[model samples]
Target chain A: MNAQADLNTTVPVELIDEFLKRIPYVSEGITNVRLLDGAQRVMFDLRPGFENQRDLVASRISEIADKLCLNYRPGSSRVLVKREALPGSYRQDPHAELQQRGDIIAFGRGRYGFGPKLVRLIEFFEQRSREMAASFQADPYNFPALIGADVLDTCRYLKNFPASLNLVSHLREDHSVLQEFSQSVRWDGEQLAYDRNGASGVECLLSPSVCFHWYRWLRDVELKEPRAITALGKCFRYESSNLTGLERLWDFTMREIVFVGPAEYVLASRDRLVDLSARFLDELGMAYEISTATDPFFVDSYAVQAAYQQGFELKFELLAPLPYSGKKLAVGSINYHQDFFGRSFAIQAAGAPAHTGCLGFGYERLALAFLAQHGLDQKQWPAALDAAITASAAHDKA
Target chain B: MTSSPNESIEQRIAGAVMRALKIADPGSSTPLRMGSTPGWDSMGHMMVVMELEKEFNTRFPPYLLPQLVDVEAIAKTLRKPA
Candidate 1:
């Protein structure tokens, strides 16, 4: 078929149907499908993927709301989840204090900011905790404490995403992409200096979610066979001049993984995740490039403990080139953290230290990039992309 | 993360002091007052107090709330040895 026809092709619903069929016991969780102007969205039950049966149906709905910029007029949407009864106390921002206890905060930015959509987002996070619980098949009490501890510390950007250094070391020695294209940073005391009190100067630290994820993994698997998939909302240092749309955010979201195992299996798994993530982007009709991340400290900084963080930068950034920004933002990344975390966490197996690796996706970046590719007008958007999104919604329902 | 408890109490109070003076930065070391800083008016003073409390990891007596007016005074309340 020609290119135009190919572009116009309606992705067969069968493909999405087939995709859902393969996953065990997952049912469609979507509610209603609506289009606001050119923005298309489908509300879905943001059910926790875990067995605790924690309902996040509303949280899932807000993610869609944010992605599509839906202004969910109150009284229009009903949440199965309640807010004021939430166990934790929120610091009151008098200027932005939410009046209603059950009200969910939405849009940390924008006119329709901080409402049910935001509430749903928090609900989504709550559900995610439940999902994590499901992954380990762990008990209920073990779940909330682990999830709630740093839940409030949730922010954007993750710095020093402590990875498996030994694994990355092994990968660098082997992978061509890593060996050549890695970037490094060095502090001259001029370029970067210590924040004496965190007190004296303004310092932005990356999200602690990755580190927290590591802490949680250690708690669960306990040194034998450790595995975890963590989704963390992250913020990064961005130039004010470079900021435009979601392409450049002082903050962003990053989903990273740390798995410790045999080298061969881990390498294969990394490739599989890359492929799976690519397929996900394809379904979104977005283009991407996979590049290796370069952390200069991965090699030399080992001798000095603090040197590693003093000079840290990403080894790889999966970028989706955009026309609007004339540049690409990292949408996803698959990093091989050979042993930094394993050694730090003292994870061992069979009396030998384990090798670890991580795969990450910048979920928000991916969504924004997809939006960039598809054009704002829903009518002009490719049918395949539309179909895939619809399928995502429908899949939720099933 | 790069903070030390011994680093001058003045440095520690910078963030909080800025909130009370309502000044984000005086541009130089010039002192800031409550109405001077962007977004720091009467309404923001509470947030400033909360921020100061969290950063110092200590709470001020509720009656002392009115006493926190300027940078120097806020500095006095901060534990010494800045």
Candidate 2:
């Protein structure tokens, strides 16, 4: 059953876009939401079984809407560089092409199994990132997919992004519990039915981003000099109904380079990469923009955190245009954490808590943007990327 | 002790910080930075901001939020003309 309800409360015009973005995640029932009546009201589309919960969803929306600070005016987005599409460039539906060519298989919503072509493209992006990291003398590191929940607590991620957390659990380490779990567990069409009491308490979570592990690794250490580390890892965020296509995934690859040391060193390192990445994108002949951005803090803290992040200009994202939809996707971000991580983890440098920053590139989103802009035909790609892919293919055969 | 009208902006800010963090006053000379101080984590920092805002009867501009990491910084921001 499909149902729609118009929000009675008025949302400020300035916050309408953000308001729309957050509504779908208000509840499991809200499968889709949109603005109406000149952004004065909202319309929510309920999932079949959730039509009865519309009132509860509306109340939650109202609660969040009331707390949203009206003081924030959307900051004039600063476009550091804007590139025009290459001649004869046209947008193609990359998702369909990738599916048709068996380049990707959908395991579930927001999950995919990459075939040779997609895998090669992902590696190509990673190699480019590795080269960028190499220029900064960044040592490559690998991090586990799971992180201690305590580490996230210390990092304040639990408070800010509770909505996105994916906790991990295992069966309790007792003979009786294990026997019960093994005996009772059965897969129904929708989900597994198992003994809930047999499960152990959650101690770890699927890491939300790769850079957090670096901070956890350096905790309580004093740095005599600045250091840079790069890693490519799987990061998870439960984006609720917002999970769609390659653009928004529940689990995605993040290639991150993190710098830690004195404030000046870290800031300068972040600036250098921002410049380098812009040039790299230009070389790939991609039309993109680097603009100020804010994290999607949970709705309760959204207003304050968004304002603070934007006010200080702590984050900037590289947004590539999706031509078919006339929308832009953020393929990368440059973030300055100041002393937040340094202080939280007690990592010191130059007689003070170290400052830290990182640049994260979303590999799948980058590949999708490239395909959408340049078309799926490898021959039509920029010369450098095409050559690199060719060399990579040759390397695999050898 | 409750903050008296005679308290300086620095003292008032310190009081707010102390109240938000739920710690006793460490005297006027001792510095309190966000991470170093007990219970002054990110959430605590926001609490301190709220306390100061209530005490000063002003809403801090968002740009000023990051700079209010210590009592001195909070005092400095509060002293500025609204």
Candidate 3:
């Protein structure tokens, strides 16, 4: 069997299913493999024994797929999962007040270009993140905002939060190929070919969480003691109906303090982190309440787990009022993933799956909350926050 | 398992569902609706299913998890011809 039968093979999904049944141990050896474009990329679910054998299975699938003439790109199979997303091309600009105040320039709805005050506020949050991590001897890292789509899939992100994902694509470089593909689909004013036939299979996704990058980086690393890492990055999440000021956004900055270790340590660290957040918010004089979150992306089938988390209050959020929207907001959250990340990445702690926890701060939302509550002027800001901002500004000037 | 009558079984299942979901006033004939019931969340739904299985000595398939929405829906499934 040679791949020369023709350029077109089977649709990636069908080809994947066909090959899935042929794997040595389909049920136990493989958890899942979601084909992106049938050939370009796919996320694999590795069972226990095959954790280190991703290359072998991927190569075999590609080899068989190539012989079947499916245009298999050797070594292109990636360990991730994602699905086709809704067409997300919007042209709305930023909120007017933010633009006038020079706090941010509107690039699009949910996308912003920060001004000096906002930048300094973000820096303030970043510094706070460092301090929070330094207290535990955590190493600092700055990971790219864009992550491999396969990586997201491997983390089961595609299964849980598919609705909120934004896939990044680029125009086909070959002009003639693109011209032909585009002309084939008619734009009757309302319909768009967004047919992806002319576009590249998405190579990367704007990360929705900072912890994903850190976990992916820490994949398969042995940790004896509780290890902490602080990371800063721009995270993007498509807010369908929830799109509004910093309250809910499309592109925003996030600073996270992640801990991975034995179950007791991770859970204990998360409790301490919650206390740390409470202290920090109190210091800033931000009026907020810590409440358990009901809505979690534990995937649809695990409604029981979602309810359990809610019932036990495993997810806590620091809620504040969104100034412009007048809606209560969750400015911070402390979560215990409890070996979910470890299972996804094959990471082990003390010869068993590691437990993980993270604290996420919505930096931009915090800034907006501050402005909303304190009236955009730094002069009237709370004494402690005001002094810090002043020092940040003076240090920058110096 | 023979019950005193059909009404007794119906009442028992309904009361059990209500209790498992942690909803008060099991006597209220509100027609427990899934996704809308105050405590009939996903977890509660699973508990209701398990309790129903044990009470009747019958197992419900996994796919029917979403289908067993209300007390009526569950009662109907239980009454189906075995």
Candidate 4:
């Protein structure tokens, strides 16, 4: 059996919900939120402890789908929002949850969405690796590390405002026709001012990072227990307004594992992710080299940013050639955000602030890289690559 | 799932949810906040409430959907007795 098959056979029911509750904030670092619907609905219901919640949510979804059948195709409807439960309904209706049983690979919010998207990405990267090895069979060159999507962005609002929907209202006040999926939009025009100590309502143009930022009012929130490791989906950038195709997406799934402890322990945890990433690729016969990289967030800063871009390399980006993009796309990164995020969240241990770092893997990017290394057509994929891919799925089901 | 005329306020509640789900990217990990993240523009807010109406199949009163700022608030309004 493959890794996916193994996951299916071993993990008991309710694991997903338990994971969700532990995370607290599925949407970014925002507390108390999660998405409850997507592609794989039925398989999750039949999996293990969640036989109840899976059935309930699935049944509700099925009823809604049947009613809406006259309008749309199956499996395209949005079910429930992630928030507080209804007055009489169970906050977590065990009977209504799905078993989370498909595509061993997890997606957004760690909910339902294991589909062909992931399978295709994996196939593409694997193919690329095989071709590289064949070409280098006679010569010698270092294999590239894989980087997943964790493109970080920073922002400053138009005006000092509370973290609320009012920010959206402010944008609406300026323009009424902007689309719904517009990730970031800014205003222009400079201030007409004279030299003064404090100019009244002075307007200064600010460069905004057109990326996602957290807004939930929270503090001292813990993403994991003192010592827990996990991997899950994370979004990259979204595509165009139409919202079609995987590459065009602004948000993509991320396989992020966080560690908290002393600096040494944290570094050790990061090494584990790197080791696993290389091992996973190596098992499929892909050669790769692990390098060091710094945090993507501090890119625009002064000395540290320049060091990362020019000299002191702490952050590492995995780069491999792709047939689709025709460039070295990043598959993942090993980063050490020592004490930064921990301080921001007020997380502490041993009478001092904790150190935090994450090893992010772009599962889709890895899949894509594999496809580019191997061959796009499944029939043409190398025997070993094919076997490994199938093995992963089988492992999930075991 | 049927509601009465006195429950029109409930329709407004539903309207907000529809607008919330449709406007935001289903794949996003960031919280869906107005004017904070990229897509939550004017039309985005309108779409959120509009989709909410579709979800509940009910029309909301004027200025009803915008009142909701987060999912918890939406659930609170929806669970209230008409």
Candidate that scores best on DockQ: 2
For model 2 chain B, give the 10-residue run with minimal summed lDDT.
Answer: B41-50
> Model 4: runs farther than 4 Å from truth?
A1-226, A236-249, A294-312, A323-326, A379-385, A388-398, B1-82
CAPRI tier for the interface of model 3 = incorrect
lDDT of 3: 0.66
For candidate 3, give the DockQ: 0.03
lDDT of each residue in A269-315, candidate 4, tens digit only:
65655555565555544324455432222111221232222121335
lDDT of 2 by residue, A58-120 (tens): 787766676664334345556777786642457667798789889988888799888878788
Using TM-score as the yardstick, the better of models 1 and 2 is: 2
**Residue A225 C-alpha lDDT in model 2:** 92
Best-to-worst order by TM-score is: 2, 3, 1, 4
Per-prediction DockQ comes to 0.01, 0.29, 0.03, 0.01
Model 1 Cα lDDT, one tens digit per residue, A298-342: 111221211111112113456776655456567756665444444
lDDT tens per residue, model 2, B1-82: 4689999888888888898889997765668888778888655776787778778778776667779998777777777777
Off by over 4 Å in 3: A1-97, A172-175, A178-195, A296-305, A323-326, B1-82
**Local accuracy of candidate 4 as per-residue lDDT tens digits, B1-82:** 3345575554444435434544433333555465443444433554554455565665444324445455556556556655
| lDDT (tens digit, per residue) of candidate 3 on A1-398 | 01111113343542443343333232235544555553555456666766666666666555544543321212212111111221122212324666787777766567678888878767776677778888878888889878999889988787766667889887678887677876786776735665566687799998998998878887888876778988877888775434665666898777888989988998888878877777777656565667666333422333344444543445777676544454566677788776768877888898877888888898888777656665655676567667888998888889
Candidate 1 CAPRI grade: incorrect
Looking only at chain B, model 1 earns a TM-score of 0.68
